[model samples]
Structures are given as structure tokens and as C-alpha cells.
Target: MIISTKLTAERLEEIKNHPTSYDENSPKLTKAQIARLRPAHEAYWNVTPVKKTISIKIDADILAALQSGGKGYQTKINSILRKAITTGDY
Candidate 1:
């Protein structure tokens, strides 16, 4: 599904306003409930160790393009690489 920029902004504002509507008596999970949920949350945090790293060369123009995109270029590259790996397209 395509997300329109205007709808995205509106949805974000709706989420931002949601907290203000909460009442003091809003239903909350008890300590026992949270204890039962902890295992699933912890499982998500259990990550496998990185086995290796490799240095690769890229064309100057491509490197410049990433750099020109500004801050978080390395993070953007990592995201792109992750997507490529997931899709087996690299």
C-alpha cells in the first residue's frame, strides 16, 4: 500500500494526541501480567553474534551520492544492505 505524505502527517498527529486522552483509571497490565509477558520481550532482544566483517570498494560517484544525502548515510547504507540481503537481490 502506498502511504501519502499528507495522511502520514495526519496519522502522526493523531498518535501524538492519543496520550492526552488517557484517564487515570485506564486499564493497565498488572505486575503478574507483565511477568508473564517478559519472556517474549526478552526473546526479541536475544541477538546472534556478528561472525565477520568485510571491506568493499565502491565507485567514487556512488560514495559521493550517499555522502551528499547528509547525516546517517552509513545507517542508510546498512538499511539498504539489509533489504538487499532479505530479498536475496545483492
Candidate 2:
């Protein structure tokens, strides 16, 4: 990610004129914050790889049910399956 921080003299003057627009001493993250974040970060990295797709068939009623919601039916199906796997409900 590329971050650009260019502060012109005019911009600095505007900030000084409106200091209240910004939050001061926003809560700092500590070691406890790092500990709390580790599990979710690790879980994200532990995801299994998706295999390549192949031709398949399903009941016409089920296909219609998925397609009735609107566009991107295939993506929606994948999202449903992913949520089920994540929640151990599949």
C-alpha cells in the first residue's frame, strides 16, 4: 500500500485552525490487543485452498431457487457453502 502524506503550509494552518476536527490520544493498542487479534489472524491464514471447478448437475428446482435471488448465482452458492463450513453447520 502506498500512503502519501503531503502537508502544505496552507493545510497545516487549516488543521491548526480546526484542531477539534480530529481525535486526540485515540486509544492505543497494547499487548492485550495483539493477543486478542492473533486467533482471528491465524484462522484467516489457515483457510484451505479451493479446488478447480468441474461440470456438475443439480435439481432444476434447486438451481431455480439459487438463481431466483438475482445475479451471481454461482458466487452466492459459494458464499453459502463457505459460511456453512465456517460455522461447522454443513
Candidate 3:
């Protein structure tokens, strides 16, 4: 998640004049830890799979169960369907 703030002109000027200082005593990463780091795109695929909009009838109870989790219920259903498709284990 990303957060942004709108700073006033005075606040921006203050920041430019006196930048925040970092803690010198803070813990540093080890060589092994640094080596394990991967680019964000590598760790999380940047590709967005094409999506299709269609309607399929599902059991009322199952639909209720999926929606009980709240928002993103459609996404949850998509994930379940994708898993079933890949593993052939509906």
C-alpha cells in the first residue's frame, strides 16, 4: 500500500532545508540477506492476466459462503476456479 500527503509550501521548504536524519546505529543487512533480495517484478509477476466477464449459476449456499468473507468475493471465486482448473480438482 502507498500513502501520500500534500505538504504546505512552508513545510516543503523546511524539508528541503533540513532533511530528516537516519539512525547510524540501526541494524544493517548481511551479505547473504542482500543476495536473497530480488527485484519486485521478479518476485511478483508484473503481468496482468486477461479477464473475461461471464455468468455461471452456483449453489446459493456456496455463493453465500463466498460473499460472507465480504468485499472481493468475486476475486475469491475467481481464485477458487483458477485453482480447480490448474489442479483438475473441482
- List pairs with backbone clashes in candidate 3: none
Candidate No. with top lDDT? 3
TM-score of each: 0.41, 0.44, 0.46
Model 1 lDDT per residue over 1-90, tens place: 965567577888876787544457865666566545545577776787474567889899988999999998877888898767645467
Query: Model 2: runs farther than 4 Å from truth?
Result: 1-51
Error of 1 at 55 (Å): 3.0
Clashes of each: 0, 0, 0
lDDT of 3 by residue, 1-90 (tens): 643367978767767899545576755666566657567777475568899889899999999999999999999999998777655466
| Candidate lDDT (C-alpha), each | 0.72, 0.74, 0.78
For residue 77, give model 1's deviation from the true position in Å. Answer: 1.0
Number of the top candidate by TM-score?
3
**lDDT, residue 8, model 3:** 77
- Model 3 earns a TM-score of 0.46
Question: lDDT per residue, candidate 2, 18-72, as tens digits?
Answer: 7443345665565556445546467678877776787788899999999999999
Q: Say what the RMSD of model 3 is.
A: 17.4
Residue 43, candidate 3: Cα error in Å is: 12
- The local lDDT score (0 to 100) that residue 51 gets in candidate 3 is 93
